[model samples]
Target: MTPRQPEGEALPGAGVLPEQTSAASSSGRERPFSVYLHVPYCRVRCGYCDFNTYTNLAMGGGASAGDYVDTLAGELRLARAAMDRAALPPRAPQTVFVGGGTPTMLPAGDLAGMLTLVRDTWGLAPGAEVTTEANPETVDERYLAALAKAGFTRVSFGMQSAVPHVLRTLDRTHTPARVPQVVAWAREAGLETSLDLIYGTPGETMDDWRRSLETAVEIGPDHLSAYALVIEEGTRMWAQVRRGELPLPTDDDEAAKYELADALLNRAGYEWYEISNWARPGHECVHNQAYWRDWDWWGAGPGAHSHLGDVRLWNTKHPVAWAGRVAAGRLPVAGHEILDAESRELERVMLGIRTREGLELAGLARLGPHGPEPTTAHGTPARLVPVVGRLVGEGLLEGAAAMAGRAVLTLRGRLMADTVTRGLID
Candidate 1:
């Protein structure tokens, strides 16, 4: 998805964001802070993925894997110094997530050392959730053990599909058998496990999807995230679709797959906590929750986005460019936007409605540009009550939840979540 445009003027230069200092300075009690470290290296790029990543370790200008950790350390130090300069209270990171093309593509030692850097720089909060995204083919039993020994508590594998043809279509390197092995190894190493799956691939059949889900259920990871395939523009899959080499996935096809996934996962004892994620009771991902719940996080590495209260900042997309700025004692911030109240409310509504907890009815009052007053008996904004009623009447939202002053989505609503988001926002 395209990033929400910055409401404020673009950053003056590639240095620190102009609003960063003020956003930090005016901070009151520290909110939950998390750190995201992006490892941009990949053994091979998936055809459908558009993440900022590189397969060439030999990319010069301090972007090679040999010195990646060191270069990233420079940015972390700069981040801490920036925080100190702005008198921001030093809060231990509640969670640390390492995501990438495949973070495990780096040596286990590199991943461990980076985790050490984060811990030493700002101590980890007690029981902090430390996670890294791993590709099944890139890691082994020994590698997972090393990461666990270095304080990594969770591992999310990119097990996009269990069917051979589906994997081939996505350009995924790992075979179907590798997922169970890595998941078992992560379990043995005392780390929580999560699996990510994608549905609605070009040539995927209903039986293929069902088989994948059954295999995943049998593997039984702590958490499962089944995302519908999205063919982003400029990606290889997008090009194929444009050329008619691959059929574009229809909304109906995707919606059916989504419904099947929910039913299968739910039968397997996983409950939906968010639109795309399910967990076994308390195994919900803390770092994922941090984003949906609007926690303050600093995203380090190329092209990662960070948010501090109303301010959102992102790094330069290219690793070489990111490294050069860090080497020059700069923040490598490409640009930032300070969110207005309306943008903030829109975001709150958009993100909150996706979760199972949903949003409180009273909160909708502040979503308007002019901040309308609550006029309903239960304090829902007067204008929004009819919209909620219409959605409830249409079976898109749960009528009981609406009466209880919460805007929770029914199964149908979850499938048409964007519609609900727009109705509430508009």
Candidate 2:
């Protein structure tokens, strides 16, 4: 998933497929598709979670692992209906990402079985990238090897902090020592490994942050995602800060931590392919790339979101409600919106500026020259005219790229990406 669509946020478009979408559907295929299955069951709710996840006993309708997969299979049929309605081609998914509520909490066989549903329904494209998010403590050699044999190509472990105090502050249950063991197990099982890290916790100090980064680098995983912790309104972390029991992480503090991570990870041969992600060459998460590059996808599970062509849809938030709706032969869509041209450009700049590729100036008519400008001009979008020059002067944008029809962020610009994007859109 894209960094923007955090666990709870899929709670929030169409573009061309990359020419290779030649799958056989009754309707001629025009674009590629990806599938994301959100397994909303977790062993314990983390302190900072606002995602729609339930504990084993708490899952209503007596939703066991088997029933949930059956429900997902039903939802897959609904997805096919939606695809047929939209005249989308039946191209197999290029990537499949099973996210969680700690997907590994379920038995490994259940995990593998869910992928089987995808394979039978739409089939996996050759060399498809399949990944499942796991809690470090949940998987053992047997479990990971099972996952690998089940066709999982990659596994991402949540290792929030390497410092014990930091882990305690975040209410993480796993010991820091367990991360290496888990990573080793996954590798031995022939699975590629990625580690997720979080910075900007209430009590985390400079050294604490440094220790976490150093520890993660020492593990030699293929990918690393270090996110600045945002206190979602109803989460325990937010409530603690509201009651003054925990200090809030300030902007400067987060900036320092981000810079430290960038320097260290880059030194460790990880490239900053996206604002919040670093990966070794050839190890970038394919599922994430599908999202960032704006391809079509179907999101499954309660409160999951899907984008096909220009229409965006979201499912109901509760597990029981979603299951009931799908069981009743409904699409389980709660609401949807259509993206107009301006809205699409806004999204383009918003998503594109954060990427290493940079945003193309041609589509942004809001930028560039105005007042009866020739349609033939290379960069004459009226709205972008003044802002581009101004940002380049401020050293927030690379001047040469701006002059040459792209908006690549400078180092300082990356530190203040939202502000830079806002200026372009405004």
Candidate 3:
């Protein structure tokens, strides 16, 4: 889930962090190099979703889907100006992800046109990973093939569950049968396919989840992401559960589902790269990795968030307001944050511990913001060694990685990663 509204004002050249240069380049010039485009139109609003997306009907002529491409173009121009004002140089993206209320709901050519816009504005790097999230029922072979020809390297389908009742509970529109068909289409178009699933939905049984998992794996997707349903406040699911019309999944059930997913996916030859993500050896989502690796990315489109070095910014959320601002030649940016060194270090520890590569012990040694560099026992501060030792003794950290100065998670640690992180950073 995203913050409903932006938090800080958009400042020109003001969002660049202390340690970063403005220019974005590859070839040894380390940079946060990706772009995200958000398409806020949806055919219908799903009960469980609280994303910043509006139904076409609910939008009420405030924003036109046909005008979205031009709106995004205007936003891109504004992005260029904002970065230039910040003295940040042109940042060609290495990864581009198009996400939405269902990006595929747009005309096939419109989606392609958006990618072409990215290509023209800031040339994508060679072999760059470009992805769009798709709804299973929203795409056909011709559409998928057109996207492939337009330089979309991957497509992730929103296939929440395999059972009809489970899907009905979540308000998903696609049938379970449509999933493999789309995967096949994507593969035929030479696009890597990933399936996204949700577990722990109300009325979903263990057997139901297993059927979903088995079906997803049997379809041969290159990657899979199974998230536990989070019923955010203000969402329809939240209201229903609150009114006693729906029951929330028990925590124990949730844990069992998580374990089941990991086991089944692993047995199917997919590696668990992050807590909820799995992929065949080379099929990991590059755009997502950029986030987990602490690389920066520019989020285009309304209500999207961007991070450059340590500066985090988000655009105005409403499509109508966002389009209006961009049409008047304003950056759609609504708020931003320039993360202090302490916040940065803490974030690094938090994000890193959840990944397969784990956190570097060297990272944990630094002082918060302007504090003195602490004295070191190994690569990190001397005081942190006991904490590291304690976690290792508890089997929350891989013993070898600790000896080698990294905080890789043990199997048990993966289940309670936050607990281990608190021991290190708290």
Candidate 4:
């Protein structure tokens, strides 16, 4: 269940704590939460990217990046102060994740400065997991070592495909050879390493998908995240599809590749802990887990989103606007909504079902009694139960009998998840 603040009291920073509130002592009563920083600058924009990112050209040839960083540091200070006023006791962040257009795009010194700010403002917990996402082309032994020294214990590299043609089609600039070298560099630098892969591209075949999986596993990352390509509107890929320049896979074809990935990765000793994320035991992303479990997390950077208790908020998506607001000594908040109980519950279900831990059955039971086997707009609850049941029968789920008492998806349910979850909650 979502935690509630006392009625008639204003929430911290309008229900979002600033950086100061994130100090080690103010971590609240529960296990300390996580932190996510979005670095919205990229060297080149990919055709498929729908994230809030700007090309390097917009960074003003690196001349304005330092200014942006200074502004970010100032924002952090203000955030810390806001957190303090919120009255949340000091608590060290459990995990810190720096994700991006590409965090590696930042100069090593800039990256170090970001980490230092985090330490000074939030106070990293002892043994805190600090992770940074990088593109393969930008990582090297020197860069990897620098990141390790700066307190990044983990590195996630975008190794979307090992095939050169596929990489070209996706507008990724890295070569297949670059990925393993970077992985080796990261491991030698004493950082846990993970690689991301995308499958079911427009012209990608099942064989190609399998080859990509095999190559990624052979590179030996501690974690892997394989995602099926989604054609998001407003992206270059979507435009290509409209112009008949690319043909997407049929549902059956995509399903075949998904099944192949699951079979291969599971046999290769990776756990499918989430729909798209696979990790070796003890290597699951703690920061991401905080998000899946609905724990409080703070985001800083243009277009970053934060969820604190029942409130969800986002910063200005426009980099210029964000920078201008921060320069003016005001929080760059764009908009926010206080999520109601039902909305929060639904969000928990959607996110939880995507993970291996599934939803907590006991907690769901406490949410309220079943509503005559509640049916969503899509279908009857009874029909949905069997979809879950079949997954358990297939050994993709555990604790099925207990699930009848609580609506949770099995691992197989996670694989064919959209259908089952849509049926349950519409």
Candidate 5:
């Protein structure tokens, strides 16, 4: 089925499909899919954030948020048409994630309208996981109720730390008091709650990290994401550190804090599904899992990315350019690429190693000639065999059925996961 081009429309740039394309399933069978919508506006930019985002870029002076939403709706329509043409069966998206600078920065009505477009175009499945990233300071009773009514089942808040000093150091505006209140309000509104916490800040002590973890557990969020602070190039935080105005923890200290997080959250009944993410049983972020599992998900809005099997496409990063192209009845895509086998294998290892599930031994072997042997038959690599043997000997990793054939990370392994994964992939 070809998408009906609107009157006076022109074809988009190189490699961009014209608002629709044939969707022939590689397996000739229907597959489950997910959707991701990027809301790139934030009330204020955090010093450490490197996401493609605009601060105070709402409806004024050339930045018309209304126009942006309209363009998003157009993109949604094009995406649906593309799927329909592909001959892929019409299945409701298993998950929908609205991540941003801060999705809550948009007016509640505007945000609701965007979600409505998604539901109307893609058709949400019953019990589909719909999540939005919200700021703690933006969570009010009214906004929470509105979001729930709009079909959001999960809400992730950026509560970097529970201490005022830590927050200030992060240049975050919200008070720690707002964390519990937001979680309570979201829970009351019938949405599962998740919180993002940052550890290993310059001045953070073990006690400080412990307090943050304890407070998060006390609030009882369904999910928690604890990330170590990294100073990315071109970020204000990096510049400040270069000038010695701000300091970050050394790698060893950060590793210790990561270990501390594992101890606290695991004791609190949270499972570390991925390196930076934990959740209570059955509360994992389905949308994020889709990415880690390498499932096909459509991304909309500026700087968004989509992958259908091996082909990955991304939209223009500039919101204005994206909207203008869609307004002209063209797909707003900026670039696309079809990944080769080696690239896919590398990506799989990169993503897979970060999760509780290590790389599939058989799949890795099939990827190339240099792949390692299955742990079941030959155990770990020759270089690491002695190390694994010693670790097992010391009672670090359990040799159970769940971990029977895989070199899975133990709680201790998770702390030094990057180093271990590097050795394995190398």
Candidate 6:
């Protein structure tokens, strides 16, 4: 769910973090970087969505879909200028992800041009992973071919469900048969594919959920993401539940579905790389990895958020307002926050504990005021050893990883990740 945008003034060189000056000169290249492009248009607004999206083709103020990329180009230039103003050295993006309201809703050429714009402005890293989110009903083989020709490496299809009733409940507008056809087309076009699924939709049965999972695995995409349905406030689905038109999903049901997904996908040779994502050996989504790893990236487009060092900035939400600011040659940023050291540490432990690689104990050892002291045999501060041991004993953390100086989650730990994070951070 998209939360309320934080308030802050847009100032010049606002993207710069204090440590960037030193890091930019020395070990900056050690960090991974990526770019994100947000497309705010969708054919229809789904009942369960609270994302920053619009269904109207023309929202006035020169913000129509036709010229949307041009405005995005303006933001790209602004992003470059902000980095330059900060005296930050140029680092080409290692990954670029185009996400949406449905990115495929735009013409293929327009999406291609946006990628081209990114390339021309700041060159892409060699072997850069460029990905776009697609709605199953929006594209054909020809369209998929166009994206591949534009240096696109991956396509993640939003195949929310295989059951007609579940799809109907979620207000998804694609047929079950269309998924395999699109996956075949994407494979034919030489694009690595991923399928996204939603579990625990209102009125959905365990059998219905199983069918969706089986169908997705049968289609054999390179990667898969299964997200639990979250009925956020202000969304239509939440209203339905409030009025008793639909039942709220139970945690017990969703947990069962998650376990089902993990078992099925694991048997199919897909490993869980993140809590919600699974992939074959090397097929993990690098663009998303950037977020989990706290790598720097520029997020362009309306309501998109960018991270640089300790700074987090977000663009204006309304398309019209965003376009107007960009047309005036401004950065289009609505707000930003420079994270404090404590907040940064909390975030580090929070995000780090979610991955298969686990959070490094050496890093956690540096959290105390003494900072960077020698660690114990397990590579953690002596004070934190007990906390780590407790978590390991409870089966929430992997004992082998903890012994090896990292905090990896067990399958049960994935469901209770928040508890593990608090144990590590508190």
> TM-score, each model?
0.94, 0.89, 0.93, 0.86, 0.86, 0.96
Please tell me which model should have the higher lDDT, number 1 or number 2: 1
lDDT top scorer: 6
Ranking by TM-score: 6, 1, 3, 2, 5, 4
Residue-pair clashes per candidate: 0, 10, 4, 17, 3, 0
Candidate 1 per-residue lDDT, tens place, 1-426, comes to 222333435555434445444433223545789999999999987889888888888888888888899999999998887777656678899999999878988899999999999987889999999999999999999999999999999999999899999999999999999999999999999999999999999999999999999999999999999999988888888999999999999999999999999999999999999999999999999999999988888899988888886788888888899899899999878777877768878888889999999988787665447666656777777888899999999888999889878899999999988999999889
Lowest lDDT block of 10, candidate 6: 17-26
Two-way lDDT contest, 1 vs 3, winner: 1
What is candidate 6's lDDT per residue for 1-426, written digit by digit as tens? 445788864554434333432223123455667899999999989999999899987887868898898899988987887777776678889999999899999999999999999998789999999999999999999999999999999999999899999999999999999999999999999999999999999999999999999999999999999999999898999999999999999999999999999999999999999999999999999998998888888888989998887778889998899999898888888877777778888988888899999999878766448667667886787778899999999999999889888999999999999999999888
C-alpha lDDT values of all predictions: 0.88, 0.81, 0.85, 0.75, 0.76, 0.89
Q: Identify the runs in model 4 with alpha carbons over 4 angstroms from their true place.
A: 1-31, 57-63, 366-411, 422-426
**On lDDT, who's better, 1 or 4?**
1
Ranking by lDDT: 6, 1, 3, 2, 5, 4
lDDT (tens digit, per residue) of candidate 3 on 207-257: 999999999999999999999998999888898999999998887898889
Clashing pairs in 3: 8-335, 13-86, 32-296, 342-369
Off by over 4 Å in 2: 1-29, 57-62, 366-386
Per-residue accuracy of model 4 over 1-426 as CA lDDT, tens digit each: 111212322334433443333223212445456778888878888998888887753554222555656777877776676667767666678898898788788887788888898888889899999999999888789999998998889999999998888888899999899999999999999999999899878898777888899999899999999888887887898899999999975777877877788889999999888888889999998887888876777788887876665666677776777777777776766766676667766787788777776654333322236444454333325445565565566655565433644444554566666665554454
Tell me which residue pairs clash in candidate 2: 14-309, 29-89, 366-383, 366-384, 367-381, 367-382, 367-383, 367-384, 368-381, 368-385
**Model 6 CA lDDT for position 376:** 84
Question: Per-residue error at 410 for model 6, in Å?
Answer: 0.3
**Between 1 and 4, whose TM-score is larger?**
1
Clashing residue pairs in candidate 6 (N, C-alpha, C atoms within 3 angstroms): none
Q: How close is candidate 4 to the true structure, as a TM-score?
A: 0.86
TM-score of 1: 0.94
- Model 3 per-residue lDDT at 343: 83
